[model samples]
Every structure is written in structure tokens, then in C-alpha cells.
Target: MIGLDPWSPQAPDDPGLTALLEDARAAAGDPVAALALADRATERLPLPGTGRTAELWRGLAELAAVDLTVARTLEPHLDAVAILAQAADAGYAVPPASGTWGVYAAEGPGARLEARPGDEGRLVLSGRKPWCSLAEHVDSALVTAWVDDERRILVAVDLSHPGVELVDEPWVARGLPRVRSTGLRLTDVPGVPVGDPGWYLTRPGFAWGGLGVAACWLGGAMGLTRRMRTAATEREPDQIGLSLLGKADMALTAAAAVLTEASSAVDAGLVEGEHAWPRCVRVRSVVHDACETVLTAAAHALGPGPLTGEEEHAARVADLQLYLRQHKAERDAALVGQAVADGMPVAWA
Candidate 1:
């Protein structure tokens, strides 16, 4: 008979497991991570109380990572939307399965996807979407389409049904590739209505989603900083080593400060009403700059050899560089300009 001691200190704790636990705890505050965790945990743990606790923890974590204004603006719907979409993709039953929405910068002919309420009160989606993140994994999507007189309408469609095709070409982003962004084609698929036409701009979804992206980028940046520090400490002292060390410290400090400030602002409810758009844009700018700065520093410190090397740190640096492309700095600049034109003070100006 084998005896198991529940309180035995001699029980070995796996270092990898311990590290994973710490990572999960840290990620709990990030909306993306929290949402992902909630989705995964709920799937695995069906117990009602346990599932609720996991969901609560995930929500709390998201709140901790973002500002209250941003959260309030987007959290009401985006959280449920993303999670429900993921769950549906994973073959779970999700109510309100089909809807319509639109995409920007689409490829192929007839780039617009439209949805209209059907006789049975369902939505019929028609159009194409490029760069639909997690499209392949979702059961349905809310797509945007041009209505009468060129007005936009939000429509939802079921991906599992015919007329909905997900292109296998996945978005090759450095981080969060597991989310599996892909192109989607909908040729009159069944769908449902979400909100008023062209309401995506008026809703908090875009802003909140941007914040989630920022959090994920910040996480990757922090991970890179940690790897760089470790590598610097382990390497032989040289000009590259010294330069890398200094840059890592500076870049990490700056990025961390900006992220903290943005998170604090979100948590404090300073992002609502007329101030919402401008504040969100400003935070996006800050995150974009910080991501660039940190990635550059990491790459410079590691050098071309380690950067292209097969090591984990090298791979991470490469991934960070790739992920930075998603920031859309030009768009942020445009938003800032518009805000300034509208009499909002540009923070840096």
C-alpha cells in the first residue's frame, strides 16, 4: 500500500509548474489573458460554483489590467462576445449564434459583408472579412455591411453553416497567434442583428479591444525584458553586453511606467464620456511607443547572432518584433491629430 502525505514538505514541487502558476496569477489582471483563462477553465471545470469563481477571478483580473472608463465602455459586451465566440468555435452551444459586423482593410472583391433581419427574425450575413482574428475558431461573427443609401449595419452569422468559409491562411503575428486570426467569407449566411447600424464606432468594443491588445503587448514586452536581463547577466562582459544591459534597463523602466499609468487611468474611471476617445487614443499611442522601444532595446542588446539564434530568448525577441507591427502607430497619430483639432490637448504637446 502506498501512503500519500497531503502536508508533506518532501513532496517535490515542479519548478515549471510553480512558474506557470506565477504566470497565470500575473496574467489574471490582463483582459485577454483573463478572458482566455475563463474560456479554458469553464470548459474544463463544469461545476457551477467553480466556474463562477473562475469567471469572477477572470473579470477581476481584467479590471485590474485596464482603466474603468475603458472597461465600462467595452466590458459590457466585448468580454461576452469574445468568450462566447471562442466557445462557439470550440463546438459549444451559444445563444444568439449569428449576427453581423464589418471589417476594415479587407481584400478581395466585394469586401463588405452585410446582414439583414430575416423572416424568422434571424440575420442573413453577406460579405467578406480580412484579418478576422479567431474567425476560424468561432461559430459566428458579427459583420458590418452597407445598407440602403450606403449606411452600415451590424450583422451576425453562423460560421458552422454553409456560405461561411474561413480561409486557412492564418495571421502570422508573433504573440497571440493561437487566437488564429484568419480571413472569412460569408455568402448570405444566416445571421442576427447586434446593435444599431454603424454602432461599432459609438460602442466601447473598439476601445476596450484596443486596451486588451495593449495589455498583451505589454506582457510580451515584460517577458522580453526579463529574458534580456537574464541573458545579459549570463553572458561574458563586452561592449554589446554593457550596451544591451543599459538599454534593457532604460526601455523596461519607461515601458513599465507608461503601462502602469495607462492601467491606473483605466482603473480610475478617467476614460469615459467625451474624454473616452482621446484618452483611449493617448494610451494606445503610449503602448505603441513603449512596445517599439522595448523591442528595439532587446534586439540591440541580443545582437544579430542571438536574435536569429534558436534559443528561446532569441525567438522571443523575434516574436516581439513581429508583434510590434500590429500597433498601427499611424492610426494613433491620426486619432491624436483629430483630437487636437477638436480642442483636446495632446498630452505630449
Candidate 2:
């Protein structure tokens, strides 16, 4: 595995997290085992936008490099914690600590979840929540449900509640197959309001959390880049192999720079208000593009030998490709371009 970048301030020395990541790498094939490892990793992660935001992102990147699905399973758990933290800081109701958590805020075309007033002023959720990854595994989740047509509220729900139901949908994806993302069917499930309507998406931590996912993409790319580097070194030194290595290195370097700068900005409390969305869009786009470049370079350098013969390499390629799609590509770029067009400061200097 590629070690943390020593030059980055985001890279901190944590022996405990290091050992956990090593264990996670060893258990990459077993999703259940890896998720257990991720649960243990929760305490090790620092809340983003805090003083140790760099370390927080570094931990996420390292986890992703180990296994994208493992990272995927764990990231939402961390994000849920961050959201709860934000809510707590804002004097909102917070749920009792659970074993593991997930953030299930994805909406789809089917039935939608709604929060209704319950006994003793509590909220109860009912309806279907889609795109809930590890819904069967996590102990709880911070879910988003419609309070009305114009308002959606974030609520913390216990996954093991009697009213919660997991749909047995067949997940046939080749990449990250271990972490199945299915839908949840709720029947008046008890829930605690996390934040007010629109707070989940509007918070500064939301942007910080988005950047955390970008860090994972960067790590997955680094994993592929390492395979390319090893392939180039193991065999005869051809100009083509060297060129690919150079390409991967250059792309990763640029990605790391943007990630580091953005991470520092987050830690400094600079990612807030009107600037958060644009800044996050820029960092995510840059890192996503860099990951794409690295993937291409690695494929060219290592050829079909590793792709066919290596299980890990093939899995990483597929996993990275799927995970990077979370960035939304040109659709997100259009938002950034619009921001630039609207005269947001472009500090290239």
C-alpha cells in the first residue's frame, strides 16, 4: 500500500489508525469483517473542520486506499457523527450513542420517507428510503425524510427498530459488491430530529463531508498508481512504462496539492457560507479528474497482465471507477463554472 504523503500537513502519525488500516487491508475481501474494523476505526477519526481536520481526511484517504467499499461503509458513519456533532453544537436534539451509524439521505423516484409527529413530541418515520448502503448492518442512521412537500428534515433512526425493514433487492454491481446499497422500508419507525429542515444540506460540515469523499477517491487512485509503479520497477525499464509512471505521479501530486489546500481551508474555518459549495465543487472536480488520469495511466503502464491476473488490482480499478462517480463530473463542473461566472474570487495566485 502507498504510505501517507509525508509532505502533507494532512498526514499525521497515528500508530493506532495505522494498525487498523493494516488490518482492514488484510480483511478487504470480507465486508462484514472489514466493517467491524471500520467500527473500531470510528473513535480514531477526528471530526472534520476541527483543528485536526487534516488528520481526519488523511485517515479517510488511507482507509479508501485499503478498500473502497470499506471506506464507503465507514464514511457515512463518520459523516453521521459529524452531522450529529453539528446539531449538538447548534443546541438541537441528539440521539443516544449507537454502535455504528449511516447517513441515508439519498432520494429517488419511488416512495419517499416522511416524518410525522409521534407520542410525547417525538417524530416517527414511515415510507421507503432508497440508496441506503449497509442498511442491514449499521446500528443506526441519520436519515432525511420529508416533513412536507417544501420541507425535508434530518432524523436519527435506529436501524434495528421493529418497524424498520430492509428490502431484499439484488445488487448486481461488479465493483464494491461487498457493500450492498439497497432501500429501507419504514413503518412508523421511532426517530429523533437531528437538525431543522434544510440544515443537513446547508451546514458547512456538509461541504467538509463532501471533501472527505473526494479524499477517498484520491486514495483509490493512489492505490492504482502504486500498482503501476511496482509493475514498472519489476520489469525492464521501458520509456512507455516510465512515461506512465510520470503521468500518474504528476496527476496525484496535483490532486494531493488541491486536497491539502482545501483541507487546510476547512480546518481554518474558511469553508463556510456562500463559498463552501463552490470551493467543494472545485476540489472534488480536480481530484476526480486526477483519479481518472491516474486510472488511465495505470491501465496503460500495467497492461492486461495485472488486470487479468491480479484480483486486487482488478477490484481496485472497478471500485475506484464506481466510487469516483459520486462526484457527478460535468454536472458539478457546471456549478463551479457558474460560481466563477457570478464573480467568486479565483485565487490562483
Give per-model TM-scores.
0.66, 0.95
Candidate 2 lDDT over residue span 1-349, tens digit each: 1223521223336778878888878878566776687557778988888787877877888788777878887888888888888899999879765578888889999869999998876799999999998888888898899999989999988888899999888899888887888899999898888888899888999999998898889888878877776776687968988988888888888888888888888888888988798889899998899999998988887779888999999999999988887888889989998988887778762
lDDT of 1 by residue, 1-349 (tens): 0002101112213454233334445553233543333333323322211113222222322332222222222232344454445435445444652332223323356456665667766667666777665554444455666665566755555567878787677355554334445677778787655455655455533454455555445555555656566776686768876776566556545544554555545445454456566666776577667667767777777667665664455544554555556666788788777877887755567
- Candidate 2 root-mean-square deviation in Å: 2.4
Quote the RMSD, in angstroms, for model 1: 10.2
- Report residue 209 deviation for candidate 1 (angstroms): 1.8
Q: For each candidate in turn, give its C-alpha RMSD to the true structure in angstroms.
A: 10.2, 2.4
Evaluated against the true structure, the overall lDDT of model 2 is 0.83
Best by TM-score: 2
lDDT of 1 at 95: 61
